[model samples]
Target: MSGQDTSEVGHGHGHGHGHGHSRSRTVAGLLSRVGHAIRPHSHDTADKTDQALEASSKGMRVLAVSFAALMATALVQSVIVAVSGSIALLGDTLHNFADALTALPLAIAFSLGRRAATRRFTYGYGRAEDLAGIVIVLLIAASAALAGYEAVVRLMHPQDVEALGWVAAAGVIGFLGNEAVARYRIKVGREIGSAALVADGLHARTDGFTSLAVLLGAGGAALGFPIADPIVGLAITAAICFVLRDAAREIYHRLMDAVDPRLVEQAESILSGVPGVKGVGSVRLRWIGHALRAEVDIQVSDRLSLVEAHAVAVAAEHRLIHDLPRLTAATVHADPDGSDGIDHHAVLATHR
Candidate 1:
């Protein structure tokens, strides 16, 4: 038999089996089972778990607050570095500016990502946040490159820096500010599962460490090792580059529709455990921002009627959605047992 002929026979047999199994569970029974399965967990709070909007709003608020704090520190740090003529402190100030730029996109993304699902876009705009994260990573990479170049130039021709005491004190203040912002954003991001916020938080925390390095470099320069200032700048640039590379990889996976393997296994286990399903044929999953879309094919008895087959498909879909909270949509295709016939070929041809 030709490849197409074999596929036709297989599809026909699967459809026949699906029809036979559909009658096992009525729509009402399936819905009741789904309800029971989907009941809220004991740890869920009435106020917090009820609304996506509330959760998204809180996430945006946290990010906005963190951005404001970073901006304030950046302005102070910039002024201090300019006065002290400290190359290390100036490099840290530029890092803060890049962070501030990233924050604007994050704020815009959070505000728009919460739009309700529409007819054309059933999943809304949640993925916009993920896109914003990608932008942040790119900006960090650019900043690192720029900083590295400047550090190399400074190293080639070292210059004396003044006002060492004031510059060090400003560095200390910047570090404290960045630390507080980073911790707050991280806490809120985890609570709301906001990737953009988490990325921003991590960026801020790194800035804090870089600020401390600048303070030390400024002190070293004052103590006669003038090259320490540019050397510290080079170190900070390397660290930022590492962070950018990691974030880019994560963003790439999400954008390319790579599903979490664990999630796929969990879904397969749930379907296989359903009472009447004899075998599973194929499963596919993809990510849509924070949510997942799943599709599955299953086999059932060939003697069942069309109505019976539909019921089985419904039951399977309900079970999948009920057990998997992250799944926003699912499609189930039913097949029949060993009744390979030419009619199945026609069905496949029509869809193709």
Candidate 2:
């Protein structure tokens, strides 16, 4: 027994069966993280980026269909703007066209995200989706700037907008097109757990509201108050800036590896239920594209053999995957249950 190897486990500071910590995370983040923990990939097959790639296919299909609809709407609005010389219609046309173009970078991102992992980029190209989010934020900001500028200019030099009825109709058309696209993108984005797609959908929703502002302007101009057009455009600009701020925040959280606190709770619950686990340690989760990857530490009895400890860890991992269908990969660490447990800090430093 003295010569036989035994595996000991110990927990780090804070997390234990009795420890309480503030959790900051969303339900979406929680579910995604839980999913990754439930469907863990073994360390030997960690390079299986195919799972990530296949998940992005749904987003691509959504982008394709939405792009076509927006393009047609923009084209129609641009022709009307050119013929009518309505400053208000011009703002709406530019916004519709700009919003439509956003799908370009997003499309590229989804394609890149589906690529297999490489040695230089071991995590694969999933972060490209976050980069696309930045692109979206910028596009939204640009639209806001353009709208504000046009509104100020129109306010200073009020112009008699021609074809008031047609301008009014165009505004309604923009609203309908944007609303439909928004609903579709948001629905699919949620289904696929794509933050980028969801953000883009929010952007479209704001655009739809701005389109209605164009309607207000058209209506006011018809009633002989020409300044109403630019006023609505200014209002639309403010709304766009609001959307930009929110979308950027969500992407920032992703880049920072922020996951919902519920995921931690979910992980701990499963680890605690494992037959050999004595105490659950730290559990962390993050979204890489739409998939979640989980890393957790568990404490086992000091008396357990090295093989037994490893088996316990394996068992915990299997249970996680069995419980959550969305979880794709997990890394579980087993520690000896006591203060005299293996000095992981020292061992980690040695490995580093």
Candidate 3:
């Protein structure tokens, strides 16, 4: 028998085995039917799965590199500020150190996220990326709070800052380094659909902007306007707080499994286009890291046999997976037209 026939037999056997149905002749016939159903799209499905895996792997590698570079630059800045004795530089240095610390967890999360699903983790480690993003948000918030407090203290005490030129020079270096890394990460992250990498890129970009503020603050302090340093520090703190708030809101929505209405509509349109589907019942889509998990229900004729229904549902699943770029899995539950007394279309429409 051909590979297609073998795959069909395997699929039929899987379902039959679960139900403890022992009809050898019937199984053979069903397997042949499945083979016919699946043959046309087999190659396409395989290609899409391959592409998804490749893209995910490449994205993780880019994230690792970006995180490492950011950490190294942050460590150097921290050391420089410690020796220079400039409050604005010291604050910038501490912020960079915190950013460096966040990178370690991000690296681990990226590594875990790239692994295949196992018995212990049915969905793989994809959620690790999302969790890492949440941690980074919290870290940013903490950094902002610390900086704000320090800035306020400086404002009240009004201490003299030494080595303004050196501090400004370090800020310039940080600004350049951060801008380069941030732009690189952002470009790659969007291509691969990696939220964690994208968030880190934003963090790096923000750091670059804050570094400019630090430079200005130090320069102003040197020219005898000591208050400029404290004011700039306060501005940096406020920006960090704003970023943290937005990140937290996004994280909360994702964790709650909020479905994007547009994706649901897209899935519905795809499924409804299938030959045997009489109507689309419901469509649901959820994000699992950079990937999506989609579930759909369809209404078919009551006159159709169980085998026909199964075939149609399977075909729809295959089409949905192929059509949607980020979908990791697609499930279709078949329902007899108007049999369950639930208006599936109505439910889906309400959701949309």
Candidate 4:
């Protein structure tokens, strides 16, 4: 199957064998069971597909709270910048405001992502998150450019930065605010498996460091070295630019459907472990927004009937969804054992 089909695979076969299975109920075992049930777990061949936006909902909550915090931070810093006339503080404040605004697009994307799939768009609106990711990368780039421009201008045209103490205090405020937001965003992003949100959290962390740079600028100005202020501002700009490279790379990978090799390996391992699966073949995994979707190829006995082969496929798929975190769906394609790696025509002819 061409892997573009993001739809989950399902089967309705009822096997008629039942028996009591023995298992240990150790503390670890009980905890494992509890964890498995608690997480947004998917058992392969799920009767109903998981709501793809469940994580997006969580993402929305995080973004909302962060947006408010950043807004307040920017407001306070803006007041300080106006009173102190510190160019460095001004740049940092502007960046904070810009960063705060980015949450809006991501929130919109998450909301759009919750909508049901349409006939024209078979994959639903999950790609909106990736699109929002692009917007976020661009915003980071723009913030860096603006900050850099301001720093270079100030360097060429030196200005007396007044109220060093207030500037320094505002810098601390920025750092505290950004660090708080960073911790929150990173925690929620990891829980929801969102690379975009994680990248944003990293951006916030960079902002916190830049805020510290503002304190350095203020100290330098107070030490009879006005040039240190612009230099520190430039340093802040450089930091933002450096992190922008990472954010852009992350977004590029997502747009290209690049996934971690470890996830692919894990899926293959689980598929091979499933009963009746003779061998694991190709395993492809990708992120549709924060959720993972997999396409697995398994080799099973050719001697089995079509119904039995399908059962094996369903079982393998169920195990994959259950074992893999953030796995929303899996499409398991069952091929006859030993048919893999052989000429396609040979297998086709035998079947014919």
Candidate 5:
């Protein structure tokens, strides 16, 4: 029942059921406070960095493929726009082109993300993706503004939308290409946990719908309502604004280091289930680019020696790395219950 003997049992049955008495009490209040104030790095393995690299590669490939597809679609639509002079078709073409160009900033971000952590930038360049997201949001806003302007001008001076059949064909072509790109981007983005890519995919999805709007405009023009073309252009502009709002919100969340609350819940559950952990403390998770990192605190019996306590912490870390999706690194701290009357805070003072 003494400290040393109990510690041996604690370490050996680290996966055993929780100690009933200790289960109800929290043990890491000071540790949690200090840990948050002065975060310590417990794990940053090369394998995690390699995983990040693989994610970046996947992102780059998505961007390259989608960019080519959207560009080709826009080029075809531009040719039709020149012949038909349909304002709706013209607005759709511009948005497709802008969406394609957004890939450039993301490409740069992925490349930067691959670079190793340096003394100057210890967290590495993963935040570059968030910055690229900002670039994308601005581009969407710009496209919306330009499209709106053109639509208003066209409304004031309505022109005959020529070659109605060709304009209608271009709409179908735009929808097909943009929709295909959207599906691929969204699928891969979710797989990799890439908000930027997901946002871009949403942008592409809207582009597809606006392309369909072009078809409606064509129908209106054929019925002698030429104003329908400019009106559809305005509709497309409004869709772009919605996309802009969504994309900007995503980037803002990332910049603020917001993560899904469910991740924190999952981490807590995993730590609580660790055999030696008497209780779980704060579990924090954040996204750096497409990857995830976590910092957690756990309480073990005060009977456990430093080595046994460390073993518990290591077990918690391993569980997190194994169970969490996209989690690249995790830091776990083991706090001791104060039954032994040994002051752990005294140790922190020495380090300070």
Candidate 6:
């Protein structure tokens, strides 16, 4: 029999199995007696484009709302800073403003991600989100440097903080605004599987905590310790640095194409359960933007004709698409059990 090859792309749907299995005995079936264990995961693959578009829309809304909220929070704190001359409040306000502005790059990214794939960019514009994540990290670093610099300068030249009550109120406002934005961003980010959005949310959460530190400075200033304002400023800068570290690390992992190991195991289990599949081979999955694509290899009987093999391959691929979440495309290769006593991989063994 000649070798058969097949490729398919599917969005989540179930199809009747056309090919018959002759006393099927797959490697995966013998490995466990507990039966198939599938976790609860669902995907709206029927309308993939619509799903992607909706995710982008959600991201845009998050950016818009968060930007406006942070801007308003900063505006209120800026007025307090002018009247009270509190360096801690000033640092917190600047961070809030910077945090809000970071949304611009992410908005652009979401817009770019919505564009259809072209020959020059066959993978589409999903990686733009990771680039936006890089921009966010840089902005965070810049905010930290500025906050730290201002604190040192203020420490060298002590000054009394006026309107302590207003400064305290501004801190409360900042915390409330930032915490709300953080929760919303994180919730939507996980839903859409957008790492950049989640990182941005974490950045907002840190800003909220730092805003509360402004209250400590106001309390110290009220107690006759003028240096407390600058000290609090430095503390806020340290917190920003921590955020910078976490955001950078998350972006790095995404850029490196890191995924959960459980996803791979789950994919293998799904493929092995398919009828007519005798053995499972390499199963590879990767993210192209927010969605996932898979490549798999399966062993079939050498006695089967080329058409039967192709049908088996298609069946395996169909099973994969229906089971895996966010899996838009999959390539399944069917390898004969033992063809003419020849080793197909011997040609490439030397290279390895």
TM-score of every candidate: 0.78, 0.82, 0.80, 0.85, 0.84, 0.85
Quick one: ranking by TM-score, best first? 6, 4, 5, 2, 3, 1
Tell me the tens digit of each residue's lDDT in model 4 across 202-233.
89988998998899999999999888888888
- Which run of 10 residues does model 5 get worst, by summed lDDT? 1-10
Taking the tens digit of each residue's C-alpha lDDT, what string does model 2 give over 82-183? Answer: 877777777777777778888888888888876666767766676787787788778877877887898899899888888888888898999999999999
Candidate 5: tens digits of C-alpha lDDT, residues 124-237: 688899889989988888889999999999999999999999999999999999999999999989877788898788889989999999999999999989999999999999
Q: How much does candidate 5 score in TM-score? A: 0.84
TM-score of 1: 0.78
After superposition on all CA atoms, what RMSD does each candidate show versus the true structure?
7.7, 9.9, 7.3, 7.3, 8.7, 7.3
lDDT of 6 by residue, 3-97 (tens): 01112232112211223434454323322311221211123234555667788899999999999999999999999999999999999999998
In model 3, the clashing pairs are none
For residues 105-222, write the lDDT of model 1, one tens digit per residue: 7777766666655656555676777778778887888888888888898899888878888888878977898899989988987676565577678878988988899888887987
The count of backbone overlaps in candidate 5 is 3
Model 2, residue 128: C-alpha shift (Å): 0.8
Considering lDDT, where higher is better, how would the candidates rank from best to worst? 5, 6, 4, 2, 1, 3
Reference-based lDDT, residue 337, model 5:
61
Candidate 2, 42: how far from true, in Å? 7.7
Error of 5 at 45 (Å): 4.0
Taken over the whole model, the C-alpha lDDT of each candidate is: 0.70, 0.72, 0.69, 0.77, 0.79, 0.79
Clashes of 6: 0
